[model samples]
Target: MWNHNYEDELIKCHRFAVGLAKEIDYKNQRLLEMEHKYNETMATVCRLKEEVKSKDTRFLEMKQKYNESSATVKRLMNETDLLHSEMRKTQSINRKPDEALKCKKKELDQQAKELEESKAHNDLERRSFLNDIEKLKEELQAQEEKTDAIENLNSVLLVKEHMINQELQEARKESIESLQNMLTGRSKLGIKRMGEVDWKPFGDICSQKFPGEDWAKISAELCSEWQEKLKNPHWHPFKKVMENDEPQEQIDEGDEDLKELKTKWGEDVYEAVTKALLEMNEVNASGSYAVPEIWNLMEDRRASMKEIIQYIIKQLRAHMRKRKRC
Candidate 1:
């Protein structure tokens, strides 16, 4: 019984050992396949690990670039803000000069308008001045013509006076001869003639008293003295007398020649000459009656009052004759 039990135990033990060996063989085979697969998986894992490592290096580079770009953008933004501030200041500074330029332009336009108006006024004044000059020229021409007419009238009168003087001288000589003949006949008949006196003896006595002086010589001296007196500024022959009244005294009352003529030539001759002088002064006092200036062609000096009166009378007669003929 003991042996049988021992055999059974040994058989069981052998079976158990065999089963355990087979199981161990299967496990070993499976373990070899796993090991092959593991070897392939390990190669794949190494390749994947290498790719992950490259990706990590690229990400780090991108992060560094992003930081640098952010810094640059901040700097650019600050420069833009400064530029805007300077532009605003420039616009504020330019405002006043632009307004002043506009005001200066307005003033220049006003000055130009005033200059145009002044030019127009000057043109009008020039035309007016030209018209006045034309009128003055016409007046001067008329005055010249009147002066020429007056000169022509004076020349015609001079010739007629000379002829009349010669005829009067001839008539006076004939009358003086007739009176002397009658006086001689009365004295021969021994008849007393009223107011008859011998003038020849009286003339001889007067000549002897004067001693070498004659009437002609004394008359020339008196004329020269009178001419010098006329040159005085205060010497005026015509007195301002009332109408229809004679002057109280002659202007030449103090003249020595006049006193001598009165004493030598007697009162009648002095009175005749004085009356002629007074008439000439009255007629030639003023206005148209005043004598025109006449030059004596024969004597080469100023014309006497006697010559001027004769010239005026002849001019009047010639004008009257011309009117009658017309």
Candidate 2:
């Protein structure tokens, strides 16, 4: 009976393993599908961008053609006017009345034919231009619609990606907790992430502060104001290292000047700096600010204090992006 019970337990564990394997396979399949969809969307966006460029080029070319056609029409109309002037001058003359009248009438008829031909050609060209313009407008409208669709798709994908990521994390956490529970023979395994950041100050600033101005400049100005308020603050980072009597270990991260300020003030000063950057970044309106790109703008050894601020802001931005992604 004990052996039979052991066998029954083994069968149950095998079934559990199989179910887990099947679930993992399903998750993997879903991940692949999401990645495939993402790639396809990016390709479509690139294609649309190229199409927009081509459309702009075509529009410019059409505009040039239309301008040339207009010039030609103007010249032809002027010629027709000149012929009318000549006819008026002939009518005013008294010499060789019948002969001159007959000659003038023949010339006028020939000129009229040329004028009619020119007018017909101009009308045809105008119609062609209008048709092409209408076609171009249609293309632009279609492009706009596609852009809206892409934006909507991106929004949906972002949300779905978030949900999937959360599900994946929860699944992994549950799996780990299950193994631990089995080993320890406990019903509960306590695990939790960091507490939420207080966004009330940030929200208040967004609501009350400079509405239309460039927030970066405002932040820069605020930074300057803070420096003015601090009677004796290290402007240069290297100065802080030099001020110390004892040689310090190499900093793993952070600018020396900012680090010194942190030593002088509090570590939580970052919250203030971060708040300013967040306001300046306008990330909700735009998207994630690329930190690697910003870092590249400065050569590591030669960057200034101002650049250091930018680097710090970017670091904060990178952190924000990671937090938001998670």
Candidate 3:
């Protein structure tokens, strides 16, 4: 009876394992389907971008053709007007018979009617061309909006993919731990195996790479590597490092210089000097000012200061030149 019971429990465990394996297989197939769909979406976005580019090129070509056609029509109309003027002069000078004159008048009336029809047709074509241009503009705007939406969707997908990867890694870790526990649980039966793994000796590897380099040089190189790693403008670590690196003495000296300039030159000269100094820097123009109070005051008075200083400097420089020449 005991042997039968043991066999029954083993069978039950086997059935559970089989069920888990089938579930895993189904999950893998679903993952593959999702991956295929992601690939298709990416391909579609690429094709759409190419199509939009082609459409823009075609639109520009059409616009140029329309402009050229309009110019040709205008030239033809001018030539027709000149010919009409010449015909009128000839009619007056020739003094043909009254019936011939009436016939000529009838022919001129038909020609005028044809010309008016041609002008109306040309006007219709111009309106149609303008409508086509407006349609293209609307399409371009819609395409741009779609591209932006796709970009946003891609960003969201990237975040989801990262989350999925992290979860998968955690699952793999849990599986490994479970396997290790099962092996250890078999130690009482003398069925356990043991081995050791050690971390690579990073210090030894470094020593081997730089066999004769001193510790000081290695330390300095490491510090430089760390410095490069920390140099992100948006990161707090680099900003803090930069602020600390500025010597107190140098900062005090700079403050003293600014104070003295302000005290001697007053607010106007101080503002002008600050503007000149800031304007001298290309980066300052491109980037936001670090010192807002100083920069704002200078920027507010910049145009006026520019004109006044320029005039004053020109006079002073000319006076100095004359004195030197004399």
Candidate 4:
């Protein structure tokens, strides 16, 4: 035997080197991803902090303005009290046989007019201050809400990091297991791969099954490079709603025949009607409404589908635009 143990050692070393390389690559990729996310999150946090700082500055300015307004109001009130006391003293003097009564009366009238103008100005300033305070309060509330949303985002990020760590651990465990299999005189190793699921085809399937289901709606919302957002595992619609989704199962005890009709057709009939109502030209729409196939579906349920069709038509040009870009 030409060093059989040495050959075995060499084989084991090769396998270890391969596994180590793979593990390193995996770790490096994950590190890059985590760094990217960290940078982005840090940027967001920085932006929010700047916003908060600005808001605080504005709030302080507002507080100063409010204080100034309060002081102004207090000064005006004190002036009013002094004016009333002076007017009383003038009245008493007038009652004691004044020489320049007309002159005194004219002076008193002028003073009263000035006082009225001052009061009006004071009232206007008070109203302005109150309005400013209200606006400030609204802004503060909005800022607080934004802060709350940011905190929630941070929490989500933390959860994502935790999940990623768990995934790395699992990958390591699996790698160890694979290595163990290779060493234990196992003849075969089977590998499983995850395939990608295309959403558009699935949406199309859903659309056809329920034609009135607004396939165009999804296409309408699609924009440039929007799919890049899907890279974030936490961003999926189902993942988002998974935590809080409480399905409310309710039984509809309406007309049995109508319910039966709905159950038989599912969403397709409604879609067909939607297509007829929405996509057709005016002449076609009017002509199709008269057809038994179009109206009978709704008529059986004792519902006026025509009204809703008319309403939508009046609201917007009701037509399903073909998906071109997405």
Highest lDDT against the true fold, candidate? 2
**lDDT per model, in order?**
0.54, 0.54, 0.52, 0.51
Output the number of the TM-score-best candidate: 2
Q: What C-alpha root-mean-square deviation, in Å, does candidate 1 show against the real structure? A: 52.6
TM-scores, all candidates, are 0.25, 0.29, 0.26, 0.27
lDDT tens string, model 3, 261-290?
467435543444343333323223222232
Encode model 2's per-residue lDDT on 255-317: one tens digit a residue. 655555456444454455433333323312121221111112223222233443454466579
Candidate 3 versus the native: TM-score?
0.26
lDDT of each residue in 1-326, candidate 4, tens digit only: 56998899999999999999999999999999999999999999999999888874664565566566566656666666675676678788766644465565566566656656665665666677679989999999999999999999999999999998897656544543443323222212222111111235335545665587676565333311123232333322221123347743222325353245346544443233223322232213222222111122223321133433443354344233323322
Ranking by TM-score: 2, 4, 3, 1
User: After superposing candidate 4, which stretches have Cα over 4 Å from the reference?
Assistant: 1-99, 183-326
Model 2 error, position 166 (Å): 2.0
Q: 1-326, model 1: which lDDT tens digit per residue?
A: 99999999999999999999999999999999999999999999999998888764654444454455455445544554554455456558864445544464455445545544554554555456558778999999899899888888777676677777776555534433333333333221212212112233334444555667784455445444433443343545443445557545354755565577678666554554454355335434221222222335455444454554465566579889999999
Error of 4 at 188 (Å): 12
Where model 3 places Cα greater than 4 Å from the true spot, the runs are 1-102, 129-133, 140-144, 167-326
